[model samples]
Target: MSTTTPAKVTVITHPLVQHKLTLMRKKESSTNSFRRLLGELSTLMAYEITRDMPLQDLEIETPMEKMTGKVIDGKKQVLVSILRAGNGFLDGMLNVIPGARIGHIGLYRDPETLQPVEYYFKMPSEMQERDIIVVDPMLATGNSAVAAVERLKQLQPRSIKFVCLLAAPEGVATMQKMHPDVPIFTAAIDRELNDHGYIMPGLGDAGDRIFGTK
Candidate 1:
């Protein structure tokens, strides 16, 4: 976690996540190692993000007696991944809430403008009845994340939370300015964004690292 976090932004400081993030950040880490670390780190982050999920009491019969248990309705959860890099979080989160629905919003940042351009959008039905967790590996310029959240809002989902492996101060400010209602969760909030809108000292192009395109 960084020394400062903006209002409504949560930096997950779990040791395991921090350790894996360190490994992922190393330029020497292989694509296989980076991908695997991201998966393991995402699972840990997901656990923290869903901490406040409301639980309902359920009655069940045990071999010896009847008892009441609390459980969340996984079906009411929706994870929206922002394009290629965001897909890396899918498997780890699914491991936690297997019944949760999945969605994808394909958005890429224009090289010149650093603005988000949408190529595809798909979501589960009855969005109004579900809570959405938007996933993207890096919140650098925040353009793509902002665009994705803007689009998802059209469906009027119950709520929305943004999650990333790393975030820059500029990006967090941008998101907080535009979508103050949506909380942000990340492993770390780095120093700043570089000239080209990349997070300073970030784990390098997450999409490239995850897919080994670079």
Candidate 2:
């Protein structure tokens, strides 16, 4: 007999997430609407990703009496945006955890190789003590996510989680294979990537849709 552990992928089927995602996917959705929805959706997804974050009790005085309240413990968290599209996720996540440190990694795919090439990289100091969450709107080919994680690993953060609005099966598999320890949280997983490495039925180029650019 053989046993196997399932891949660490979380598909957020929450009704709100599903509904907003549908709106964003429509070809007729306006840029303002699409960008607004992404912000809202990112907040919902952020809630799920940090569900297990550690907390410590603090003694506080209520209006009527003293009480013990729970607050997130340890070092402030870090949100690493994978550039361009990833910025969409950052705004909403900051609303949820305003104190979190921000980092950015910019990589563009080489058309011929379909591999990620880093163009910019910056991160907060003391990453070793912080919980890091990497955000990108789409995980289509997985090249960028894998490469981003590979680079983040060098910093040795306390933990790393990847969050996206949509993911293709190939992308999920690639991340799991390359960095199995990093969990993935997404609103949905579409069928597969098309020949050009775009997720079928995806919301199109997220960076373009969000910014109303070609």
Candidate maximizing lDDT: 1
Candidate 2: list runs displaced more than 4 Å.
1-7, 73-75
lDDT of 1 by residue, 55-117 (tens): 999999999999999999999999999999999999998888889999999998899999999
Clashes of each: 0, 0
Off by over 4 Å in 1: 1-7
Please provide, for model 2 over 29-88, each residue's C-alpha lDDT reduced to its tens digit, 9 standing for 90 to 100.
Answer: 999999999999999888889999988899999999999999985346999999889999
Report the CA-based lDDT of candidate 2 relative to the real structure: 0.90
Could you estimate the TM-score for every candidate?
0.96, 0.95
Q: List the residue pairs that clash in candidate 1.
A: none
